[model samples]
Target: MNSTTVSPVAEVGMLSARERSDHTAFVDGGFLYVWGGHHSVAGEEVFFPSDEIWVYDMSSGVWTIYAMGGEIPPTLSQTCGCCVNGVLYIFGGCAENGHTNQLYCVDLLDGMFTWRNVTDSTGTPPSPRDKHSCWVYADRLIYFGGYGCKQMREVTDSRRFITDEMSWVTIGTMLFRFWGWNNEVHVFDPRTNTWSEPQMHGIPPKPRAAHSSATLGRMGYVCGGVEAPSMNIHCLDLETWTWTEIVPTSTVPVERSWHTLTPLSDSTLFLFGGLSMSGETLSDGWIFDVHRKEWRELQHSHRDKPRLWHSACLGQDSDVIVFGGSRDYALLADTISVLQSPSQSHCSDLLLFDTQPLPLLRLCEDCIGRNARTLEQQLSWLPKKIQEKLRKRILFFRTAKSQGTYNSR
Candidate 1:
């Protein structure tokens, strides 16, 4: 297929960055507010408590502690979350004491909380699950398979809740059980409040967990999650329900999990730090071009300390807000960074060259027939070396940028 090339634009501006420390939290409010789990002061592993909610704002880069008084649900982990309007919905997480099948919603605009017992409803909710995947479409929240008691058994059933009716209902089941991996893509229709069965073209990759997925326009991209052997990246076209594997052409980023993926306006996806397999945290960033299926490793001079299980979201203007994770195996509460694309003046000129022989040049038979000899004349001034270099660069960059930093050679 013919592909279009995009020149790297100069970095012209920066967005605000913030540092709020907590562990294994999620970001909401369009990247403005980050809510995270609490940790003990002794720097030891402690179960998160549901009584307090840590909140961080990107504009001021400040962390605010909120007391969730009343009958708060128990603290939990591997919980799936989604934001609809200004409210945050959390579902199906393993609590400190045991697994939980409850559903809770936190209002960002009003600062109120509501918990519902899913068992009391008529529609059958998916089995008690943890580490599941969920997303919001229109007014409905769609949930997919998660680990049951066996842990990573792949729950195939699906369920959703319509905000207008304040009710829960079961959607169709996914064709494949996704319990083993968290990177599976689940799309929902808000108008009907139902999930379309997982659809994609070609043989799908194996299931994985701790990967990152996000929507860009009508397409969804999944990147950098671990399976048995290594991390892999994939994309799904929502319109056609098709899947394509992305092979990077540059030095890819390190393999990681629990990272954040945010969509930018320029048809690119931005990825931030996460935990490497060796349990070390990372602070590097990368970008993937969705249209061209390419990847680009970013150079950050003012990068923050490495972290894992943190939350990130796009903020006002071009800003990105990140919050909460662990460092050195200890839960953290003090390091936060607001990252923005560097100013265009800071970007150095990049001379891209291709380094491959051109394919046998071909023209439309009718066009060649109209001016058969002229085609050769048009190609005379094009240097084969330069042409080859440009082709190689384009192919290399596209492959490297799409797969992220880990798989690049």
Candidate 2:
């Protein structure tokens, strides 16, 4: 597939040198937000960055760093999050001290954004966990499997535990330990402000963490993880509350963890990048057709951009914005990241993967964005996401100064 990228015509404000893993990224309004990922050495000694959030304005290509308000959650990563009704909600990740189940959110619509700790929520949140998948369905937030804070009833007998190697690796004098991964399901209903664990029937996927998921219609699909069933795909039917394993007729991807599964539409999903079970960071891309039950690989120009624990968010006009991930995968590594060290493959690059059939459409949109003032009436009906994307295109275009510097179609 042909893909192109757009860079900020120029950076603004205080730009952070971020090299992180297992962080969270979500889209809201006309902007994409990235927050709370950690950079650690040898997977134990963690380094926390500023209490801020990174915002990418789709219209202007201006990358701005904003100070977090309200009660900010500690610099966190390996957590999961999603945006709903302009609010970004984050749950369960490894903090500086340990794992936490604390639920926090920030309203992106609020000009002076503040992190609000949602304390009024009732019932039990899942145990503190990291690397889980968060899904927004039926106006509810659903979280599935991750390296937990403690073993739960849903934890199966098979699966590898991160702490299993505790005896070999040492951060200093302290020995690092964490709970194993489980296939537990937790749901939070914002209307009632309550949390509930559903009694799922049928055979559940093996307990695993660092997996990837995307929800379509009433079915929630999960693929790849650590240890068992790493390459298998399974979907939970939200209507019937049953799990059915999907047997792909074509090629099956390498077993991986920390990969990203992005829904391009309700029936199609995109898969890319992760650490394979054999200890390699994967860089290949695949597209899964939900109805056909087949996997097709994506051939792109950016093969060298291998990343794990990174994020890929589908943007307006079929664009996939990938950013902020480390390249050093245990294995099965794929995707892209910025920043490079002798040992660190972590990057802070904000890449735009334009996956459009006609590349010139992007240029036409840019033209419209540049002439938005004169053409306001013609573009008024566009969705907020598309409008922002069009407006933001000029942020780089103006800086390109007729050079088209960042255009790589």
lDDT of each: 0.47, 0.70
lDDT of 1 by residue, 1-409 (tens): 0001211122111211122233334455422343445443343334455555545332222334444544466767667776777666667776756556676665555544434333333343444555555544346565543443322244332222111111111112432322223333454443343434554466454554456767666555666654421344566666665767777765677787667777666487778877676656677777777666567776654254555556666654444445445443422221011121121011111111111122333123223333434554554366997444334334333333342211110
Candidate 2, residues 124-189, lDDT tens digits: the string is 888787777877888889888876544434333453233423322323333333345678888998
- Candidate 2, residue 365: Cα displacement in angstroms equals 3.3
Q: How much is the lDDT of residue 336 in candidate 2?
A: 12
Candidate topping lDDT: 2
Our model 1 lands, by Cα RMSD against the true structure, at 17.7
What are the per-model numbers of colliding residue pairs? 33, 21
Which TM-score value belongs to model 1?
0.59
Off by over 4 Å in 2: 1-19, 39-50, 151-178, 330-342, 358-361, 366-392, 398-409
Per-model TM-score, in order, reads: 0.59, 0.79
lDDT of 1: 0.47
